[model samples]
Each structure stands twice: as C-alpha cells, then as structure tokens.
Target: MCIVYAIDSDWGWYYFGCSTCNKKVFKVGTNVRTLNGQEITSHIWWCEVCKENVSFVSPRFKLHLVVKDDTGEARLMLLDMVASGLISESATELLNGSFDELEDPDELPEAITQIFGKTFTF
Candidate 1:
C-alpha cells in the first residue's frame, strides 16, 4: 500500500481533450465571425488523431502524485479514468466548479486534496 501525501501541482492537473474522441486537443487560435451582424469569438482546437478541428472539448484529469510506501517515496501519474474513479468526480465536473481560464490549474480542489493522507493499494 502507498500513502498519498502530496500532489505534484507544478505541472497542473488536467488537459483539454476532444469530446468525441477523448484525445488531446491543441488550441489553434480564435475564430471570429459575424452572427446576425453581432461579433462572436470562439476558441478553436485541433485534434491530431481526429484529423479535424473540434469546437467543443472536455477537460480530463492528468494528475501527478507524490506517494510514499514502506520502501520509500515516488512520483506517480494517473490519467483520466483512474483519477476520476479515485476522486469520484470527472475532470469536467471539477473544472466546472471553478473558472478554468482564470483559476490556477495547480491549485487543486477539496475533492482532490481529500485524497491526501489516505492509503491505497495500487
């Protein structure tokens, strides 16, 4: 069993992914258009595997944890599925609770921090 003492927040905790394909999406640029003479701007994202631009994307967990065992300590990386299961919340759900554009990604939420000081078998 390993005890999760801390989270490596320096690198952040989530990534933007294609909603349909669930693959990492890259932000290309902003798209500006005139809708009924009203200016509208939206962020554009590109998914390499999807081979297309996606207008909507989802945030998925990509957690870096600092865990300790009887032997020593080590860093562990957990992706979307596993992290979501442990936290009992989807990355999108967590992001929705905060302003993603304004908030620091490194600053974790209570749901994530609660895992600290807990021991689990990996």
Candidate 2:
C-alpha cells in the first residue's frame, strides 16, 4: 500500500499531486521530448489552494515526477521525472492509490475506504 495523497479539482475531475505539493493537472499530453532528454509531454493542473502544478496522465497511471530544488522549477522537473525513477516512494504510492479510484469512476468515498481498508467515520 504505497500512497501519499490526492488532489481534486473544480471541473468535477481530479488528478494525482506531488507528495510535497498537492497539485492536480487537468490537461495531459505525451510523446514529446524535454530539454532533459525526457521524451514525454506532461499535462499540468495548478492548485489554487496549495498553489502548485501536478502532472498526471490518467487516473490509474502517473508518469514519474521530477521534483525541483525550488517551487518555480516544478514545470521542468515534472517532465524529467516522468518515465524515470526520480520521484520519492511516498509520492508514488500516494499518486497510485488516488489514480486507482479515479479509474473506477464508480466508487465514491467508499472506494477510498475499500482500497485502504480503513474506515473514515464521517
């Protein structure tokens, strides 16, 4: 059970965010080359509450993330991280869990509980 957290948006959709910054990317692109030799385009979604950008391909799959030294460097790092083992374990775990739920599109709050096997008494 490797997972960090999730990031939902206002467009009735959601995406997996970085462990450090929980941002959700609405638009996703791929198969492009980056300056760091990462051959993939990332769709970035910015988070208003947290003020960060997240790159996600789909609900169940998240390309590797390239984190940066500074907050402003997120865009560049994200691409590099994709398809590469450059992200933290916690971050990967968290993203995967959230994405799994999105993939189902049928499970709601119950989906989360079912996967994690923890009950949220709300």
Candidate 3:
C-alpha cells in the first residue's frame, strides 16, 4: 500500500478529449464562419485517432500523484475511470467552466486534495 502525499498539479488535472472517441485532442486553430450574416469564431480541436476536427470535447481526469511507502516514494498517474471512482466527481463536473476561468490552473480541487494522507493499494 502507498499513502498519497501530494498531487503534481503543475500540468493541471485534466485534458480535453474528443467526446466520441475519448482521445486526446489538440487545439489546431480557430474556425471563422458566417452564420445569419454574423461572423463567429470557434476553437477547433484535432483528435489524432479520429483524424478530424472535433467540435465537441470533454474534460477527462489525468491526475498525477506522489505516493510513498516503506521503500520510497513514487509518482502515479490515474486516468479518467480510476480517478472518477476515487473522487466522486467527474472532471467535467469539477471544471465547471473553460480552463481559462480557473483562478490558478495548477491548483488542485478540494475533492482531489482530499486524497492526501490516504493509503491505497496500487
């Protein structure tokens, strides 16, 4: 068993993925078009696996944790499903708005921080 001590929040806690394929999506550019004579620009994300621009993306958990045991300490990565089971809230739920809205992008949410000092078998 290992006890969770700290969370590596430097990279933030989640990644935007294609809603359909559930694969990581990269922001390619902005799509500008005219709708009803009004010009609109929307962010475009490309999913490598999907091989297309995905208009809908969802935030998925990608938590990095620092854990320790008798031997030493090690870093652990918990993806969407595992993290969702441990935390009670989905990444989408915790991130109520776009990433830009966060006061500190590197800060961990209260729910995720609660794992600190808890022991679990990897």
Error of 2 at 58 (Å): 13
The true-versus-predicted C-alpha distance at residue 31 of model 3, in Å, is 5.2
| Residue pairs clashing, model 3 | none
Writing each residue's lDDT as its tens digit, candidate 1 over 70-109 gives: 8999999998888887896787787784324536766788
**What's the best-to-worst order under lDDT?**
3, 1, 2
* Structural similarity to truth (TM-score) of each candidate: 0.83, 0.27, 0.83
RMSD of each: 2.5, 15.0, 2.7
lDDT of model 1 at position 97? 46
> Which ten-residue region of model 1 has the weakest summed lDDT?
97-106
lDDT of 1 at 30: 86
- Per-residue lDDT of model 3, residues 1-122, tens digit only: 99999989877789988989998999888779999999987888999998998889888998899999999999989989888888877888888856333668667788888889999897
Q: What are the runs in model 3 whose C-alpha is more than 4 Å off?
A: 30-42, 99-103
CA lDDT for candidate 2 = 0.35
